[model samples]
Target: MTTTPNPTLIYPPKPSILFTNIHFYISHKPFTSSSSPKSNSFTIKCSGNASSDPKNSDGGLKNLLSGIVDERVDELLNREENRVLLDGLDKATQRVEIAKRELAQIEQQELENKKMKEYINQLEIRAAEIEECQKELLEARTLVDEAERSLEVEIEDKNSTMTETEREEMYKNKERFESVKAASVSAIVGTLAGLPISLTQAANTSQLILPSVITLISCALFGVTFRYAVRRDLDNFQLKTGTSAAFAFVKGLATLGGGPPMELEVGSISSHAFTGAVYISENLLIFLFAAVGLDFCIKLRILSPFPIETDVSTTKVD
Candidate 1:
């Protein structure tokens, strides 16, 4: 009797393929048992049809191999191995961060170096300016030294030939000449001071402010010159001072007499005589003034008619 082959039961299969130089197939098991059961999927190495190999077992051998391969893959992906790989990656990232910070510091240092270089350049320029000023000061000092030397040499040449007595006489004569010149100048200045007063006094009454102001200005000029002349002999200075005072005093009468009122009242001849008298009296007063003050200064030991200087330590250079 021909027995009918048991009805082949086929279930839908899940298949997976892997390709490289060779291909692998992963297949889900076929269910043929009357008892309902899920089949395990297994990886199979294949060149051609799986039915050709009698050694290829249905599920047992392939399931065992797939289980071993899956366990090995899971071990590779475990927490310890993954954590070690993550640590290595973190270390590389930290290295990159450190390099970036170092690069920034280096750039900052370079900028600071550039600023320092510029500051150094400015300091060098200022130093050069100071050096130039020092050089100029030294040059000016040398020139002044040379000029003082020349002046001393000239003074020495003038004084060398004269005896002490002769030098004294010469100084006295020079003093006399300077005194007379000073007295004459003072008299002229006094006369100028009085002229405005004289002119305005006769034009009805007028303020004396103009004459006073003129005298003040003239005295200022003379005072400045006199102070500059103080290094000269004390007797000469006293003579000049006394002459100035006396001239200012003696010119008062002339100024009063020469007013417009007097000019109108008196004849030209009377005016001429008055002018002559005033001029003569003014001169006499200046001489008397100089003699009195000179004597006073001498008595006080503030002046000397004959001052003696001796001892020449260094020869004057020409």
Candidate 2:
């Protein structure tokens, strides 16, 4: 029996091919008695261009390696273990970027704070300067007020001086009238007192006229002096008495030296010393009468008091 020759199965040799931009996916399983051999074998899948030229093979091989590397990287990323590791790496990178951004923001905030602090310091300095300037202004204002007050006082003093001068000029006529009134009162008193005595002792009318005129003139002079001496005194007995006695003594001296001679009377003293005593005593009586009348007139507001006392009081008030 010619058995059919066992079929001679021969495999042809594969030609070398260069691949460019090719991707390959490979898988394998452990061989086991229950599994098919095909299931345990490695598998390869390829895509992209293939060439047999040696010159073109290098570039294609390089492209194939590059594509294979990219495919392997994609596979690794898809796998569970490798994907977890890549995810951890990506999260760590994101954290690093976020940290950098936060650091930049913190630095900017610190710079802004520094600028704000500087501005505040400048404002404080300006406020202090303003306070100092205000104090200086207040002091200047106080000085100006004092100057104005002093000027006002000076002007018032000048005005018051002018007023005093005008018052003195106006009162001159009044002073003269007072003098005339006092002198006339004294002359009348003297003539009345001396006429009787002169008539009693005179040798003739000629002697009477001389003694009477002399007495009248002397008493008039005394009255003017008395009015000034006791200008406003109405009730001072001592001043009035002293003034009368002084006038009487002066009149007696004048009569003894140059007065008209008196004729002797019956049953009367005739010595020169006795005659002098009579002259003094008679003048004293005449002065007493004049003083009483003048004092009465002063009390009745017939004359003004001296102006010197009023002027001194007004000056004290100013």
What TM-score does structure 2 among the candidates reach? 0.43
Q: Once superposed on the true structure, which residue ranges of model 1 sit more than 4 Å away at CA?
A: 1-98, 114-154, 163-177, 180-192, 203-318
Q: Kindly list the per-residue Cα lDDT of model 2 for residues 155-269, writing each as its tens digit.
A: 7787577665565555666677788788888888777877887888899878888888888888788778888888776678999889998999888867776755655864343
lDDT for model 2 comes to: 0.73
Q: After superposition, how far is residue 243 of candidate 1 from its true place, in Å?
A: 8.1
Model 1 scores a C-alpha lDDT of: 0.53
Instruction: Tell me the alpha-carbon RMSD of every candidate.
Output: 16.0, 29.4
Worst 10 residues of 1 by lDDT: 309-318
How do the residues 230-304 of candidate 1 rate in per-residue lDDT, one tens digit apiece? 334554756565545554554545554555444444586587567666654554453344344444544565443
TM-score of 1: 0.33
